[model samples]
Target: MNLPLNRRLFMVGAAAIAVSGPAFANTTHIVEMLNRHPDNKKLRNVFSPSVLKVQPGDTITFMPTDKGHNSVSIDGMMPKGASGWKGKNSKEVSVTLDLPGIYGYKCQPHYGLGMVGVIIVEGEGMGGNLDAAKDVKQRGKAKAAFVDHWDQIKAQGLLTPPAEQ
Candidate 1:
């Protein structure tokens, strides 16, 4: 059957919209949990790129290059409606982040030495989790180191750059 040109264009546009949706634009980022800092021995046992900033619906894969580390979210550092996650010890875990906020995470066994990481999800604004993460009452050496990491993240405009080669 033959159709008018206008009708054909409308049908094609509608089909295109149906095929391309928000999910098609989501991205996946890879992060490594390393056993040592390449340049600083004192920084041994850390997340390669200790900080990350991503859009909502993005996924992050936390892969442990070291034998004894895990990525676990800080108790209070999630958006109001966001749920937290904890990867299996020393294993690779992929998480699809649907909420927009700041997330602070740490290695369960190495929190003291500051084996920590932070993530920020862009939303309406920086979420309410930042203060909570800062006031977490951290213990051991991490108490001071965590603060330093947070300050650095803020100084760099809230994005942790990829580790230097």
Candidate 2:
């Protein structure tokens, strides 16, 4: 079919717009509950990949690799307007975090022994709740565990994400 130049350009533009897709796809991250660290036996009661970094709209799944453990969001750890979640013992729970910030979770049965995990949602407002979450008191080995996690975050340069061009 032959078309006028303006109509042909319009058709091409429309087709290009139609072919363009979403800016980014959301991702699902997995965290496992373990009775003992998989690589290090000396570390008992832990979450494999204790610190996870994700983008906004990503889903986090807490997998139960061992019995008697559940994932529960720590109080005062999530961003404002973000709700907390608790999974039944030995059950898997998936949460979609839309708000950008730091989320702290734990394996309830071994919380005192420091089976804690961190999920950092990178983007705008990510560090808004950081200091507050850090200030929230922790008990047992959890204190030291979280301190190490924070240090790791800083050392690894995961605290602030790369700005968009």
Candidate 3:
């Protein structure tokens, strides 16, 4: 069948838009919980690959390789419009990231020892809440651990400071 040139062009443009539109499928990242890592850090029970970079709409699954651990967001580290979440101790939990920013989380049971993790989400012109993320008040080893991870993020240029962006 011979179709008009205009109709063919319109159909092609529609198809391209559909293919390049916002992604509905979510990517999942796996994080393992380890105990007594032997590396000598805060919070003996730890989350492997402590820092992860992902795009908006991705998901992260925290699996308890050892018993008695759960993932929870820090008090002031999430984006402006993002909400806090926590998983039940010893249970596997998957969190879907909808906002663009730096998310700092920790294991409730071992927060003092510094069982913490970070997730950096990059989106289209996404201005992250860097100041809020930096203000997360942690105690003892947890504070030190967060500092170390934050430094790495800055050094690696994974995400730019909101002020500078």
- How many clashing pairs does model 3 include? 2
TM-score of each: 0.79, 0.86, 0.77
Error of 3 at 105 (Å): 0.7
lDDT of 1 by residue, 1-165 (tens): 499999999999988877787545788888888888866766788887788888889999998787899999888777787788999898999888888788888889898888888888876656466777788888887787678778887788754433568
Worst 10 residues of 2 by lDDT: 17-26
lDDT of each: 0.81, 0.90, 0.83
User: What TM-score does candidate 2 reach?
Assistant: 0.86
Worst 10 residues of 1 by lDDT: 156-165
The sequence of per-residue lDDT tens digits that candidate 2 reaches over residues 71-110 is 9999999999999999999999999998889999888889
List per-candidate RMSD values in Å: 5.6, 3.2, 4.2
Q: Which one wins on lDDT?
A: 2
Ranking according to TM-score, highest score first: 2, 1, 3
lDDT for 32 (candidate 1): 86
Better-scoring candidate (TM-score), 1 or 3: 1
How should the candidates be ordered by lDDT, best one leading? 2, 3, 1
With candidate 3 superimposed using the best TM-score fit, by how many Å does residue 151's alpha carbon deviate from the native? 1.1
